[model samples]
Target chain A: MESHSGIAAVVKKTLNRRYRAERRFRRIGLAAVAVGLLFLAVLFTAIVSKGYTAFQQTHVLLDVYVDPDVVHVGNLDSADYQGLIKASLRELFPDVKGHRDKRNLYKLVSSGAGSILRQKVLEDTSLIGRRIQIWVPADDDVDMVIKGHVDRSLPESQRRLNNKSLAWVDALKEQGRLEKRWNLTFFTAGDSREPELAGIWGATVGSFYTLLITLSLSFPLGTAAAVYLEEFAPRNRWTDLLEVNINNLAAVPSIVFGLLGLAVFLNFFGLPRSSPLVGGLVLTLMTLPTIIIAGRAALQSVPPSIRDAALAVGASKMQAVFHHVLPLALPGMLTGTIIGMARALGETAPLLMVGMVAFIVDIPRGFTDAATALPVQIFLWADSPERAFVEKTSAAIMVLLGFLILMNGAAVFLRNRYERRW
Target chain B: MTTVGEIRAANPRMTCRQVNVYYGDKHAIKNVSIDIGRNEVLAMIGPSGCGKSTFLRCLNRMNDTIEGCRVTGTITLDGQDIYDPDLDVVLLRAQVGMVFQKPNPFPKSIYDNIAYGPKIHGLARTRSELDQIVETSLQKAGLWDEVKDRLKHPGTGLSGGQQQRLCIARAIAVSPEVILMDEPCSALDPIATARIEDLIHELREQYTIVIVTHSMQQAARVSQRTAFFHMGDLIEVGPTDRIFTRPRHSLTEDYITGRFG
Candidate 1:
């Protein structure tokens, strides 16, 4: 009894220390989670704050008389729409008179404003002689000034906008002619040398085609490989070697797939360079290992009893797997396929080696058309020498993140929908 | 050495001669032979790892599913060699079905669980025929009244006893000549065990059964003839009453009298 009491005292003495250690471990776990959340919060705030303004563009409202003499040139394509825009700006600020000042005055309007007027005249020939009020996009510098990105209080040498140009913008604001509208061009048009005229549509379309091919090619190939390896392949040295290679392939740098694509697809097979077809082929090779690994894991997770039940009922081995095992494993396979596709969507290095890094200005019309993926577009914009491209880069990053979230959400949705209790 | 008790039946349905089972390099089941009679329940009882379940699996070639498990012997159903390579295993399994120790229902509705075997084997010509087979199979298993209202519900949602009955019903839906049950009531409670034991009694009128059980009392209760296995060898086979009371083998007597299993 005395020895038992002594043991009890020892236990009682250590109890509080054990509880304290438990609490300390819990506190450390909470701190780790808190730190992760803080980093995520910082990233999201930085992207959103810089990119939100890119969704709205600055526009200057102008009343321009489409002089028939200037617009009705014999060749309508040769019409001087820029002259009409210049004449309209001169009409708005009649006091600005000299050549250099007039040039600064014309700089307040985007060069694409001429193309907009030309499209208007082409759509309605009668508009050639009438004075119509229209909102036209302002120059990127004027846009930066209006969005508070450029400091107007700085000296002329230190700012993108001169004091005179800032004065014209202030005059336009006073007349309520300056407005920020939804930047539809960012969604509807293609990339351009001029940042104001650029949009992400080209990159978005390229990404869609690339992923479509990647999904179609990799999913079937990966799932078939996984099923054969897991279910039918004899466990021998060759199969073990194959399994090891598959795992090793998954860890290989993605750029090696790009190099392979360059040598085999571009040089030997002679597929079109800088096309979604080639990019999709390259990405398929990159994602196949990931998909196969995931498919195998999913197939393995299915309880062996289901197979036995099916087999005992006289179902063939193939029939049993296709009818019961595949259906159960499908949700998992789809999740893996989507994850691999998401990675392929964000992939850029391989595409670059395949010539997808070319300056593709047209929205990809077909799989073989020259194209640039969203990440590559971001990379290109980020590398540009224009200050306006900074916001565009962040905006592209936001779009990429949105696509990633959408793909992951789809994975969760499919998993929940098809998941069954065994 | 020969088995100590009668090894031949007056009307044998399946006959085994000198069967041996090997797992990798281990001799799991030594040369043992027995006859399974028509429409009779044969119970195999033994201590753990004595090759009773292994011997039972070999009856329907379920041992083929396991890696490195090899069986060699001439086993015949109705005087035809079942081990003939030309004999389709799928067709053989349809002729002889199995129910496992643990209840394993497909992740499907109750109606579909019974219909799956008949449907896959093309036993039904129309939807109505399939539905009829499902109802009759469930009725025969004595689960129709409890689950008739929830035919569309998942079979896995049933209780443990109900699920085991469902698996038995699934095996019966194939219209097999023989049903091999591997400890069909071990996972169940006493009441469910009694219910299954009664079902086995009634089923013996139509289908030949071979059951492997751990409980000697279960063997005595449900079986006509009992075979006792010990250490990879079959020590005795005789009428259950004679084997429990007037045993020929000392090992069988020792196992039955609660001395040492």
Candidate 2:
């Protein structure tokens, strides 16, 4: 009786120890999840806080004379409208007669101020020989003062904007001539040296064109390849090798796809460099293996009985696959395609190799036009020395992330809306 | 005992001659000769893995779908060799439909499930004609009254018995000459099993029915003729009543008297 009691006591002790270990494992899992969520929250907060200001820009409104003699109506695109802009600033503060002070005052407005007048003159020749009130962009240094980024208590030599230019910003504000509007130009223009004029329209358009080509080429080809391999391909050594290689290709580094594109598409095919067409062809190759794998999995998940029913009804193999299996597999296939697109959207290295890293001011008019995608645009801006570009880089990242979230949301919505349970 | 090679029906719809089957060098069925008569219920009964279901599938060549599965010898439908290389398997399957051990309905509306076969066969041209076929198929399977109000509901939502009947209705919609049931009631409750048994009795009047079942009682209840198989060999076959009451082979007698199976 004493030995039996001792064995029972030991069993009880071991059970309690196992229970305690189980509790510790649960707590560890909870901690791991908490750490993951905390990282995501910190990243989202940092990016939003650093980039949200890019949506607003400061502008100085001035009354200027669009004198035809200064603009030269015949050659409006090349005219030095910079002189007229400096003259307008001088007129605003006529008391600053010294050349060095006048130069410091001229620094308050953006260097693109001349290009803005040049665009306006070309847009409407009627503006020539007439005086009109125009909103010229405030310079990056002046913009920081207006947005409260510059500390006024600092010594003049310690800051980027001199005391004279900083005082001019306050004077303009007091005169109700300097104001920050919703930066519409940021969405309307393309890449520019001036941060206020830089917009994502070119990159966004390029992304759409590239995605169109990639999706169009990959989806049909991937589905066909998947259907053949999963359904019709004979069980042979050659087909098995192809299947193994296709799966391995999905795990290959995306940059290798870029190198392949450079070697074959640019050198052999002679496709235009930096065009959405070339970028799209490269992305298609990168995304095909993923789409094909997903397509085959989706096809396999459809019950064998469904195929039997179709066959029992006298439907041909192709007929049953296209009619029943393909529809049932659609939701999974679409989810995979969207994920592939999201990965393609953030790909910058391959696009860089194909010359999408070049500074392009004009928006791409077609698929063949030279273009830079969003991530490449971010890559370029992030490497620049300008302080305002820091904000632009983060904002472009936010835009790219927004598109990814939208694509993921669409995937979930499709799965829920069309999901069929058996 | 008609000399082992001459187990034939008077009005045979499908005839098998020295049929053997293999799954990658593992012989699954030996030389078996049998005949499935037209417009009658023929039941093949055996213990598990006795090649009963394998023999039934040979009629429609459904085993062709399995990888590494090969069939030799001749199986004929009507008076033609179905194993001929030029014979269309699609058409053969349409002529001989199948019902599985478990009810398998397409994930579609009740109306669509019945209409699937008809649409593929082009048996109906106008919308009303298609609706008529769906209604008649459902009515013929005795499911129309229960599901008439919810034709648009998915077929998978039906009860076990109803889904099996739906599969039966779907098969008949293609107007097949023979219907093969591979233990159609094995997955159902006793009550559901009885309903499917009654459905088999009703369907045997128009279609040649071949069923493989483990339960001797089910075979005795529904089949006009029964063939008993043991260890991939056909042990005895006769009229259903005679096979149960007076088995000619000791193996069949052992199986029937519960001595050994």
Candidate 3:
């Protein structure tokens, strides 16, 4: 009886220990999941908060008399309109109690605002005859103050704009002279010297064209190569070597493809500098390895029995692959393609090597035209010394992240929709 | 009980003359010679790794898909050398189709699965003609009445036995003169296995059939001639009743009476 009781006690102790261990494991697993979720939440919150301020901008509204005499000067050469706009802006705020220095007053308007007004005048010469009230984008300091990026309590040495400028800005706000338009120009305009006026529309267009080129080139080439390798090619030493190279290519760093593109496309062939065509070519090389690897895996997932069934019916190997195997592998292939394209979309290093880092203010007209991608624009903005550019950089990053999430979501959706169980 | 010589005299559709198969350094098939008559069923029975299935794959050059597997000596169909390098493998396969151990229907509609072979070989030029071929193939496989109403459904959605019958229809759709089955009922339950056995008997009337079966009773019930393979060698080939009742090779006799594999 004593021995049996001792044995029963040990068994109960062991069972209790096992239960405790299981509970500990469950707690640790839940904790890990919570940690992962918290990390993602923090990253999203940080990005949205820092980036949201970029969309709103400050502007100075002025009803300036065109003064046909000043604009025309000696003749309507369209050149005099630029000086007239600058003179009008100076006259509008003459009696304002801001920094009385002429140079500081010039700082309130963006460095490139004169050129923007001149371009508008050049596009339409009839505007020279009328007195138009225009709301031009204010400089970065005024923009920061309106967006709450500026602190009025900071000393003049530490502050980006002085107290005198702040007083003038407050007076303008009180009189309803200062305005905050919907920033339609921020959507329509391209990159600018002032972060307050810079926009992503140009880079967005560039990304669109670059992806168009990448998709057009990579899909057919990658799928065809995969089909030939997986189906038609005989099992021989040369084909084996080819397969090894293809696998190795998939593992190679994407930046290496950029260097290769720099050497071959830009140097050897002399393609247009900083063009989406070159960026597309570089991205294609980077994406090819991914697409081919994915395509081959998709192709291999198709059972050999399907091929046999097709051939048993007198279908040739080509027919078997195209009609049967290709269809089955398509979902996987498309998922791979979308994933590869998303990778290309986020890539900045390769584009930098191919000169896509150049500042391109005009939107890309075609694949051959010079262009700057979103990430490259972000990089450029981040490197600027202007404090306002920091927010703009974060905003661009937000847009890029949004695109990546959308593309990956599409990949997951396609996988679930077309994935075959067999 | 008839001897191999007697079966050959009856009607030889496919004659294998001392065929050997090698996988790299391994001799997978020894000098195994047999004759399969037209419109008859021949079952090759053996323990696992005895080359019964390998021999069946050789009938249609299905073994070619396996790397390092080499076939030697002559296999003839109607006195024509099948191993000739110039012989078109696709056409050879069309002449001698195969049904795998597991049901491997194409991920397509049941009608498309049956129509695929005929469509690829240009057996049907029009939609109506292809439909006729699909119907006849299904009818031949004994699946017409059950599936005719839902022919557009995916072939993979069927039960295991139905999928196997669909594979049989897919093979027959090509109108091959010979059909090789490799353990075609191994994955099915007893009822499905019995249904497949019945289909095999019905199929023998139109094409020469060679089946690899693990079940001795299935062999005895379906085959007219049974070839027993031991260690990759054809130990005996004679009437099924003779191989089961009378002893020729000691190994064949031992295998039949369950002395040892």
The order of the candidates by TM-score, greatest first, is 1, 2, 3
The C-alpha lDDT values of all candidates are: 0.91, 0.88, 0.84
The CAPRI quality class of candidate 3 comes to medium
The residue pairs that clash in candidate 2, if any, are: none
- Tens digits of lDDT, candidate 3, B1-261: 122323352678899877899999999888767778998899899899999999898988878878889999889888878899888888988999899999999888999888878877889989999999999999999899989999999989999999999999989988999999999999999999999999999988889999999999999999988988877877778888888888587788788888876
| Candidate 1 C-alpha lDDT tens digits along A1-422 | 56988999989889989999999999999999999999999999999999988998899999989888887856467788888899989998999988999999999998999898888888888887899998899988888888888866677898877888888999999999999999998888778887888999999999999999999999999999999988778778999999999999999999999999999999999999999999999999999999999999999989988988999999988988998888889899999999999999999899889998888788999999999999999989999987888898899899999999999999999988987655
**Which of 1 and 2 is the better model by lDDT?**
1
User: What lDDT tens digits, residue by residue, belong to model 3 across residues A148-181?
Assistant: 8777787799987787667767866887777766
Q: Compute the DockQ of candidate 1.
A: 0.82
Give the CAPRI class of candidate 1: high
lDDT per residue, candidate 1, B1-261, as tens digits? 679999899999999999999999999989999999999999999899999999998888888888899999889888877889998888888988999999999999999899999989999999999989898888878899999999999999999899999999999999998999999999999999988999899889999999999898999999999999998999999999999999998898899998887
Best-to-worst order by lDDT is 1, 2, 3
| Candidate 1 segments whose C-alpha is farther than 4 A from its true place | A1-4, A73-78
DockQ per candidate: 0.82, 0.77, 0.69
- Would you list the clashing residue pairs of candidate 1? none
Worst 10 residues of 2 chain A by lDDT: A141-150
